[model samples]
Target: MQLHDFYLSGNCYKVRLFLGLIAQPAELVNVDLPRGAQKRPEFLALNPRGQVPVLVDDGQPLVDSQAILVYLARRYADTHWHPQDAFSQGQIAGWLSLTANEIHNGVARARVGLKFGRPVDLEDAQARGRQVLELVNAHLANRSWLVGEQPTIADVAVYPYLAMAEEGGLELAPYPHLNSWIARIRALPGYVDLPRF
Candidate 1:
């Protein structure tokens, strides 16, 4: 197995975090984003979208962070990480969708703008991030995990950007429940720390 990765990318970090949690070993192939290596012909062949966090398992390329997370959990992790029941699977899928859409557009995009200097409205992104955080904070107020009792890919998928929201100039101080949730995730076994900004 191998992963095309970018060190500063939260999407890439999600895959790495899961790999660590499951103790799966894979080669890390760094894509030179600053040099536009993702747009290169070789990289584009792996993912036409030119994104990182592409996992190649048994020579089969899997694109998108959420897709990669689902694949990893289902293929490698125990049932606890990704339940097999219909309703549970659907609930997890919903969170994955939220990670791809709301989390991406809000927290991740804000970080891209503020930390990476992307051409985005930082204030708008941060404001959107706050709204998303508010929703998540309320959702987590009475629950330890997103879907059920134990942690799932939903937590892994949404964690990175929210953990690093400070880089996006978004303060997490207002969300005590969310902050505790972050701490809970960090306390999980096999938890690996991503590079801090």
Candidate 2:
């Protein structure tokens, strides 16, 4: 198995974190995102969307970090990471959608703007980031995991950007429950640290 990764990307970091938690090892192929390598024809063929965090397992290329998480969870991880029950599946899917939408647009975008010097509406992104911090903090006030009693892809999916929320200039100290949840994930066996640029 191989992963097309960008070292500074929260999206790629999530996949790497999940693989670590699951005790799976995949060759990491660093993509030169700053150099526009992702837009190259070869990379585009692997992912027409031209993004990193593409997983190639058994010669099949899986694009999109969220989709790749579902694939890896279903194919390699134990059932708990992605429960087989219909309700659990739906719940996990909803969190994945949140990761793709709310999390991406808010926290991830702010991080990209601030850390990578990208052009973005920094104020708006930070406002969105704070809102997500509040939402997740409230949700995690009495729960150890996002979906159920155990750790699932939902937790892994949401962990990366939120864990690095400070980098985006959004304070984590205000969200105590969220901080506790982050600690829980960090304490899990085989857990990995956030990516450093």
Candidate 3:
């Protein structure tokens, strides 16, 4: 198995974190996003969208971090990582969607601007990021995990960018529940460290 990854990407980091949590080993192929490696011909052949965190397993390449998490959860992780029940699946899918949309547009985008010198509306992005932090913080107030009793792909999916929110200039200290959740994820066995720039 192999993961075409960009070291500073939260999306790529989430995939790597899941692989670590599930004890799955994959060769990490660095795609230098800063150098435009993801847009090259060979890389485009691997992922037409030219995104990082493409997982190639058994000769099949999976694109998009959320999709990659679903694939890994079903194929390699413990049953708890992705329960088979419909309600649980639905709940998990919601969190995944949140990761793709709100988190992606908010904290993730802000990080790109603040930490990587990318262009973005920092104020608006941080505003959305704070809203996400509040929503998740409220949801997690009475629950240890996002979907069910155990840590699921939902937790893994949302953890990366949120964990790195302070880098985007959004303070994490205001949300105690969110902080607790971050601690829980970090304490999990085989948990991987957040990506560094």
Candidate 4:
């Protein structure tokens, strides 16, 4: 399998982290996002959206980080990472939504926008990102992991951006529970530092 991704993108890092956790090795083909290498004709043929973390397996391409995580869980591990119960699966889905909507939008977008010299609505993004963090911190107050007591793909899916929220100026100091949880996740085996996208 070949995973085409930008080294520093949080979205891309999510997939890489999952693969590492499962010990699934794949060739990484770096797609230069800032240089617009993803917009090239050859790359566009793989994904119409021109995004990173495009997984190519058996000549088929899978776009989007969340989708690729699901695919990896389904294809690689038929275990607790995805879970068996309907409600548990739903919970995982819920976390995935938060990762994509709140985490990805409020945190990832603002961080990337500001770093790239783009116009980022700092006030709006920061407020919304804080709201998301508050929600996550509250939910995590009584639990060890997001979807289940065990660390699932949902946890892996969301950790990087939230941990590095400070990079975008989103502080984690206020949420002690979140800080503790982030520490736990970081301590897990097979953990890798998120590469700058």
lDDT of each: 0.91, 0.92, 0.95, 0.87
Compose the digit string of candidate 4's lDDT tens values, residues 92-131: 9999988888887787767876766678888788888899
Residue 9 accuracy (lDDT) in model 4: 85
Candidate 3 has a TM-score of 0.99
| TM-score for each model | 0.97, 0.98, 0.99, 0.96
Q: On a 0 to 100 scale, what is the lDDT of residue 12 in model 1? A: 95
List the candidate 2 regions with Cα displacement exceeding 4 Å.
none
Better of 3 and 4 by lDDT: 3
- Error (Å) of candidate 3 at residue 161 is 0.6
Question: Please, what are the lDDT tens digits per residue for candidate 2 over residues 33-119?
Answer: 989999999999899998888999999999988898999998999999999999999999998998899889999999989899999
For model 1, what is the C-alpha lDDT against the true structure? 0.91
On residues 48-158, what C-alpha lDDT tens digit does candidate 3 reach at each position?
A: 999888999999999999999999999999999999999999999999999999999999999989998989999999999999999999999999999989999999999
User: 1 or 3, which is superior by TM-score?
Assistant: 3
lDDT of 2: 0.92
Decide which is better by lDDT, 2 or 4.
2
Residue 53 Cα positional deviation in candidate 1, in Å, after optimal superposition: 1.3
Q: Ten residues in a row with the worst lDDT in model 3?
A: 5-14
Q: lDDT, candidate 4, residue 96?
A: 93
What is the overall TM-score of model 4 with all chains considered together? 0.96
Off by over 4 Å in 1: none
Candidate 1 to truth, TM: 0.97
Indicate the residue-level lDDT of 124 in model 1: 80
Q: Worst 10-residue stretch by lDDT in candidate 1? A: 188-197
Query: In lDDT terms, which candidate is top?
Result: 3
